[model samples]
Target: MRAADRPADLRRDLVVSGEIHYFRLDPAEWADRLDTAVRTGVTAVATYVPWLVHELPDGTFDFGQRHPHLDLVRFLDLCAERGLSVIARPGPFVMAELKNEGLGYSVLRRNPEIRAAGWDGERRPETIVDYLHPAFLAAVDTWFDAVIPLLAAHAVDRGGPIVGIQLDNEIGMLPWVTNRPDLSDRTVAEFVEGLVATTSREAVQARYGVGATSFDVTDPATWGPALRSPVDEQVLALHRDLGRFTRDRYARYVQHLRAGVRARGVGEDVALLVNIHGCWGERATMFPLGISQLHRTWADGDTIPGTDIYIGDLDLDTLPGLWTSTAFLAATCRADQPYGVLEFEVGSGDYGEALDVTTGPEAAGLKLQLAIAQGGSLVNYYLLAGGRNPELFEPVGDGNDRIAFTGERHGFAAPIRPEGDLATWFAETVHLTEAVTDAAELLRAARPERPPVTIGFVVDHYMTEYRYPGSTREAEFVAELERFRGSGPREIMTRALVVGGYAPDATLLDGPDALADLPTDRVLALAPTPSLDDDLQRALADWVRRGGRLLLSGPVPQHDMEGRPATALIDALGLDVGPTHAATPGRTPFVAPSITPDGPAWQGAEVAVGFAQPLTTRRADAGTAPLAHLARTGEPCVLDIGLGAGRVVVAAADLPCLPQIWDALLARLGAHPRIRITSDSRGVVVVPCRTPDDVEVVHVINVSPWDTAVALERDGRPVTDEPIALARRSGTWLVRRSGETRARVAYRPPRG
Candidate 1:
């Protein structure tokens, strides 16, 4: 964002590194840890300097004063000495599970006002603090005053090792501050000031659909409690103002903290990154709110102070975690700059479960590589390595221990040990990092955010909480959760995208893009909740005419969120929901579907079972291609005409069609231009990083911990009827190939 004219060039130059609390490691072992990191070919090293670790509220600051452990300059000097840049995070609210680290526990216990109040007005210790509280900002400013000079003096841009400086870790501390809890008088006053600047009280009342003259503008305290519970009038009145307030809160606080960061004298161009908690992964209701935040900040304003590709936080990370979430960040980031994964599960620990999913070393490498392979220009592996906890000064949630979770205390179990010895996985990570450095350019070039294809988020699972108000656990409801059902659609479509045989730009959509008429290569069947926006429905209709291939299924949308009769676009193609009968399994292996086929119907494929008495049948206007048919089940699978430039296909049944068709269908979908590689080779992860000249650097990793070899076509050659070896363990098999080096595949040796 700083180099507005030089955005791309600036992003391309970033070399994201990993983190290990150098202080946590014994000084004796720092050398080895540093060596492992350098050997890994990492560009920068990241570490957090928690206020709790360095200062105890009374204002005394210590930088390794007495013990070598507290040594600050020595650590920065080491990074510079090692030629590794550093991402310095000095948090007054550093929430890396450090006790009293973020909002001092002592403050929470002693100053009850600092704690977030619950419904009963009792302060909750978990995440104390009013984020917008003036007192809190004042406190943060005080902390910044001391840390900034040390950092500024040693900043990488200043010929020192420090490169990027992150703003306050995660923003809001009081989600409890939502509808519950009185908006601390300080926040309410600021709220009025914000409203005054952004909206007039008269306008606010008008928007809230209330009597314009009824409310007095003198005080906002009345507004908070009155508007907390939504009235239809309030929804409209507060929608824009509410968004403005939150953004103002974010911008104000961030601006407040940044004042300290900037006042320290660090180069203005040095990036200031902040992370948005993937609040949806844990509590999905938070997504719309985050989106609103997006609408408030980056989307509209050019002058707003912030970097692009805002870092998104995720608590649950799976292979295809949430492309919607990932892509959302990409959209915001790419619009301004390149995407970045500010926080991710690199070392691997969950709410409390440590050392469970090794993800093996290959998995870790796979994510980082793919991230770069995706449009993530820079990635920060949260805990490149962990060390001793400072003490659970303010243990939130389940209380703190050595590690904060039920298991280990002291965020331990890192690639680098507390003493700094590299773990077995450490070696794999080294190899992976080396692979990335080997192919940085290509990864940047092949970023999905910049790609052409749009990854569809069918109305299925991820947003079920919002999509269908009361439908949570019912069998059919669960079946239609926006994410899960839509996942199947996304996977198949992604196949076409990857197989389309070129490095296509991939954009993810959980909300509506259909209206954008985004050139659809293919719409994967993500069975989003049978609800879609009005604009999306209209978009798909235009897209079909303009030549877009749609793969809509799972549950063909039958309504908008309010459940009005839907399927306007596909209606012409014969897509419709049948009866609401319980379409359960019958007694026979080959159950007869309710329909009789019109022609050859399918290519020797028999239908197993159809929808619960409901079938999407053709109207007189529908054109059909007999892709597949099940006689016994009487299910007629057709390829609808008007695939825009191509054709539209709908499969009312789950794929793999009786285990016999998995390979072929997968192969076909893989080759489909619209389908991208939704599967990261689950068993074997293949991440391609392109070199400077666009030469692809394929990092073939055998995530399997034990030694194993994989077969893959190399240098664009045929499969050789056998896979190319992945070699034993963390083999950093590099290959140069054509079209992404996708053909330069990856797989592990099969178990006996």
Candidate 2:
């Protein structure tokens, strides 16, 4: 491919990257994963700098400072040998399910005050070290003081392979997926400093046109209460003011860490990134508008300008919601640095140490994540080759507090076993890395724009419900909403727009000012809550009258609880009626047994569409237009009709909130261009290097002593043998075509 056709270089973007834990996999295997990484075309490697492991207890520090297995220096040497880059995670509290919050037993038992506080003023037993606490900083300082210097020297800038340093693991509870406990006097103090420095009650206000005098002049504690949501809501809004407070303050802490890494000499060349809990996307918060307070800290920081990448810990393989969530983060960057998937799921292995079952080898999740992650700079996977988490070294607490010995919540289902079992999952990862890294030059340059579909949605808000039990009232509803989450909203919008024969891809970011070349009267059915902004509202109004079509499943809302009417826009569309309630409550059969819409929009996927009782409407004009209604006992609860030259679709029920309904509705929206690849849910997929001359030189396997080959696809064309490797033990094979393009690979099952 030519230069322009080649994708942008996402930080060493290779699919075959592996995860190596600090406390796990014998250091001896370090060379093995590295060699496998190279043969697999893995350009980068990721490892967590477990605070608990290095610090052992407070005041003490260790590296290979004692054991060669613990040797940090030699590890980088291996990375350099293989021309691999590194992503380091040093968490004062890296909760990879370590005992005592990843802090060696000493920190937890000795530094009780550092733990976060609950609403009751007692320290939460689950966490260790208040994120912003000074003592915590001092403790981390003791660790960084010893190791960061070594990392700084090995950073890519210094001709070594270390490229990115992750600060803290995942601040948000994530995946199965905290409290903003500012109860610590230190947090309160830092909150004051941050407000004074970045806010504006005079000193506090800058962009939003608000102002506060001194930091103390404003009651910051009140800010927390304003953001309170139901316990079921896993996320809280990081609105501008509060967002600034939380973000800027958190930025201060990151800055401290960044500086320490820099002082050690890692400098600006080694990028610094913060990982957000992917579940944060479920929080229902808007971007720049509703990013959680904790996320905004890194998401909106200017401390380290060039280091503009913000990440999230999402194993997006099976969960479609996380795909768009990661994509959205890339969109929010001021500098538009590449979006990075800090912790892509490698496999469905263990949830917690207790769950000893493995997820799968095709790593079905990585397939889609890379599609989005490729939009930016880098995508890294953790525990690329997990062995055992170091022996709890020096038992820390209530013997029950062990992450390693217990395994994941389901079981110890890692791609590679702690006992060094090399499953097919590991082989697949190696194969994927080889394909991606070999073509890194070209693949890195390709930028696949989201297809021209108008059926996409943003990912945010609603994490709490998925991670744990939600409020009794909304739990079930919440769970259902996430059903079709893995399928992206953008994809839905694009596909519908495309199949409908519209050029939505060219003018999707429409309305008015966004792109004037587009027509003004195009309407889209927006599934929104009261959170829609005034600007978007105004834009929608202008476009509708100018001939845009809008099919609101509900009404063009005119007011919020504050009773403020967003009149200018709502009045123009003239949708002033309230909803028609469903009769018979839960028994309402709104879902039609077999309802179908015109064209490809409703193609594929199974959805239930029910008939409804017709309801009354004032400005209803129906002729030659499509009408879709969902109702109760023949009474119309959802009504779709045209208003002026535009359309208005309303539903009394928020069933579309359910994953099933949402996906079906999206299908009817339209179809887009996509190349489907079948993959297993091993978490991480494999990529391999190939040339016309070496098309038949790869192999892969699944489980019980087997092997196979991964294929390669380019601009809708394939160019090599499918990739292949070994299982928990090992295996091998040869390619078929030595110089032909191959789009997809089909691996065989291992012989029992």
Candidate 3:
């Protein structure tokens, strides 16, 4: 085939795909199902190959010898004949509500060591197997030996329809509860070794006032919340390090799976896709479970980690968070790779109770459009065609038959229903797929442009939410090391910025490389913690020196990641953080501060909710200016200091709680919003994207219950002089102009 016409090249463009389970449906319906998929403008289809279903009790495997429904090879052949590519998810643990998460019952039952253990060295609530366990890997090796050869033969390079291989679904989700650094013997050994290697015996003695011989990694109590008390800084450091250690294990598991797939002759050209569950703004802070720290895990070039967004319903509060999350997902992945929403909300799902709202066609269409605008080049609905769960039979006896874990005919609101008929959402699905197909060229080259303002997403701060839930204030602070910066500031900044008519990018601050990834012209909203790493501290100092405006929240870093006193950035900026102060208790009102008119705009604005004993910084530079002060104490709350070509704004109070203050800071930095939405309606979002032909297209999404009057602007000029009424829970593509001239533009709804 010609290079341009090759299937591999075609995979790079914007494509619509949906999950279809051949194993769950009758073989007679396969042809009709494939036909329906094509009519929906789907270039690809995806399915999970469950190991539990394929393997029999007698140590023998069935490749559709008895039942055609179990015929994966035949299904791939049908897709190839229909000209639809495939995304095959062959999991030893596919947690699609399957019993034992699709693992062969005998596998875990025979080897208890492979099972994930909880805090007390007991089995977790779910039957999730540890990925790196040697015996479990051995079992996977056996399964891959049989299954991968069949999958490899159907890959596009080998002239078949398979174009992608999903490497395990939602890694780290199994044991995401509190005390979750699986206390398996192997895990404990690794954790202790990591701590001893990175930290010194002298450092440990200084913090704990004890010898290194007293350290114990195997004791579950040592890892509990008691160790986090402010007095026990040494244990707090160890606790935080354990979270890091667990993160490494998750990344290595991906590497192992990718290696296993490649070793079986699966070509490199086929995409390696992994998915993360729930990393949507404030919702992502529900960490250790639905969400995980994506920075350390998805580093391999062959692998592309996509976010799994299942917004049951669209509300005003959910819209911006979703928008922020999708942008965060795009930023998390490599810039060049096509952004993906591997499992978007196709319809209402059930988790014993109805997990989603009644998502009609309007809500469905708007969700897809917003995803595309946020940089989703590849979109896959979780269940394109809903179907009945298969009744399993074991050779051992009738008692061994497993009931359907997700209930019979699980998807009641899927785009395609269980009876080979279209659901209410079918029309919208068709429209979106067709639109994506028509605009593939434009969508392929378009990426989410970096906003002029951004709030840094420090992973270490967010990942530590699972610690010290019930500990006293002092203990919790000590247990988390000096780095107890939680999601409060990060969440507030994102929400406040959106409310202030600015959509800020979430630039990660995990390592030095993250600094280079940021757009230098942008303003960074950073709430520094005492536990900032030495490398990150230097990077932030360099950013301010390079003329970037740094917005500070809580306290400047007085210590490094290990709780060791280190302040390279603090010294560079010529500021010293003084003693901490806390508000008087018994009243919810934290701080009521008044902004000074002498500073930036938004002065005289009211500030509610005082910060938690934040440090007061003593400025060493004569040029340092105070912008705002606490109403009660008359102490400076907002301070600005000039550093080299740029400037830094440090707020003694939490910046997020003060929106008007953020508005002033943004205005002072001279940051202009790319697009502004003027609407009283909640959950109305505007996403601007540039097509390959340089056409400016804005995706307007109204997720509210009522119709909203929305207007768009570019460089302060309104695309339309008057506001357009967006229907309730609907979406549309608004094109600014048709031709090359950037002059006087005429508006028109995009052709679907």
Candidate 4:
């Protein structure tokens, strides 16, 4: 659905909700816990309707007839009485640490043939089922028949508390997390059928090389030379095809479920959401993998896409990854679809009881503000209230005694403990929620300020999920993938730009017309690799010819995505580039900065360490000027080439994250930061959002672990004369009106 065509109630807006498992909590205390959530300033509450908890031993279901905790209707009534909306998550496969991933044990036992198998033709260790298998879909249809009707009756259109219905819980999460894509017989047959239908049978055979017909095309082996260094072109091609096929299958599965739910009385009035899962712990490097895997699921703009962010803190090391993740998500989304966070990290990080560290209250505050600053309109804190995991109706001797794997009392680190008492972080949660609630109107109408630079997002770079388990060459494969298809270069470049005081926008480069749509006034930066899409390479060349400033880092494209030699970009711009190589063991690799007479005095040598490998660029045309050269070798590793009406800066070296280097490079392209911070701390991030009426909200965040005072500027004008003092790991918004001379601070954390 288009943005203009959306129903009034389904319009994108600020929704601050918290996840509260009603089935896990005692039914008697449901009112109190929900009252606490309302007191915390959340407008709504989200809960996963675990099928495992509501299903009976027989083929029937139980809606509190046998157990009080399973009374979903009662919980909805309580929410409506309190004037609180609900986001019901009835998952056919809810991976909330539940055995069989929240599916009915009886269903799985009865349909054992539906289980997903690995490359070895054996059932995978996890209880994940083949998503498209007939038996599995049939089971899901049965489960949805029991759940969707009840949810529809409680939907907002019916004067009930239900505002949104999540189609499924993190589709393809288990397979990706386990590195075991379903290779079951039925799945493989369907994949082959899809391959033949999408591309011709002849093309499939030609790509696989060994296949004479579509049926002969088998999946690549999980071991041996397929995953080793110098991988065969046929094997690599098949892997890419398999990745595409898996993503297509996931999209089709979601489409099927969406149709099912809509057919069962759910309609456009209630928002449909899809939770995307990829990031884990403190690193968001692989987050884009989820985006690529599920891009097709929501590309039609029917359902809203929300990422499941589990990143703990916003430090220098992790901040860039989160920025990349948010930017990439925005880049891939349609203009009408606004993204959000389905599982926003809150409380503590000790889910396993092994990690004795607690996530600071400031962490959630910073993350929430960051999400808002990046155009996020919806957020649901994963666990706001802890509760007990109810026992299963029938246990099958599986070590897990309760419905979930996280022991009896789950979510011990939540703001409200299992016993109905408030945790230490409860007050801070209230403060942050109130702050957002107060600024809801301003945030809903505001859009982030457009930056002068655009970062190219290549979805294929994140399609590195086909790792062979237990292979001796696994480390080598991972290293190679990191160099070619990982987020290493993207991370370094984003870190440099943000630290250099420039917030850049991202655009997906995989689309056919993406490069044509990019603004020529802004500089376009991309982390190019040898195996870039051939079409994209040609488009980049054309983009440069059309007066678009280009910044190409990492390796210059030498081969197409199919592993065939193709150099449209290199050939378009007169350049001679070679393969990238790591620095010699004990020797430091450095690039001497360019010192042109007429240009800005770009001082300091940029060094490459650890995983920052330097690519070799031998020569360029006479029109090219050397921007930076390899330090002792004196070979030009960074060159400024003037092509047609545009200019391109090719930095073959993946330099370390240095603000000075990025500032100097951007200065060469006439790109200056719109927002700047003058502070003692280097970890400060300044983000600005504005409404059409010229009301601006500047989000000043200090990601450092130490307190600091900061002064900000926008478009080269001082925001305020008085410096804003920010405590460690805190952020605040500076609201500026068009007529107002001074800016007012909002959501500023109290100083210790």
Best by TM-score: 4
Q: Number of clashing pairs, model 2?
A: 149
- Per-residue error (Å), model 4, residue 196: 2.7
Worst 10 residues of 1 by lDDT: 1-10
Candidates, ranked, TM-score: 4, 3, 1, 2
lDDT per residue for candidate 4 within 498-559, as digits (tens), equals 76677777888775577887879989888876567678888888888899998877777777
lDDT of each residue in 342-450, candidate 3, tens digit only: 8877775443445543545555567677777777777888888877777775633434345346667755567788888887568767876777666666656655556
Q: How far is candidate 3 from the true structure (C-alpha RMSD, Å)?
A: 4.8
TM-score of 4: 0.93
TM-score of each: 0.71, 0.66, 0.86, 0.93
How would you encode candidate 2's per-residue C-alpha lDDT over 618-719 as one tens digit per residue? Answer: 444442122333422333344444445544444434343233343344333332223212223122222232333434322222222222333324346544
- Ranking of predictions according to lDDT: 4, 3, 1, 2
**RMSD, every candidate, angstroms:** 7.6, 9.4, 4.8, 4.0
Off by over 4 Å in 2: 1-16, 56-58, 104-111, 174-248, 279-319, 334-336, 348-358, 365-377, 391-397, 400-412, 454-525, 530-536, 542-570, 577-586, 591-626, 630-752
Model 3 TM-score, 2 decimals: 0.86
Between candidates 1 and 4, name the one with more favorable TM-score: 4
lDDT of 2 at 616: 46
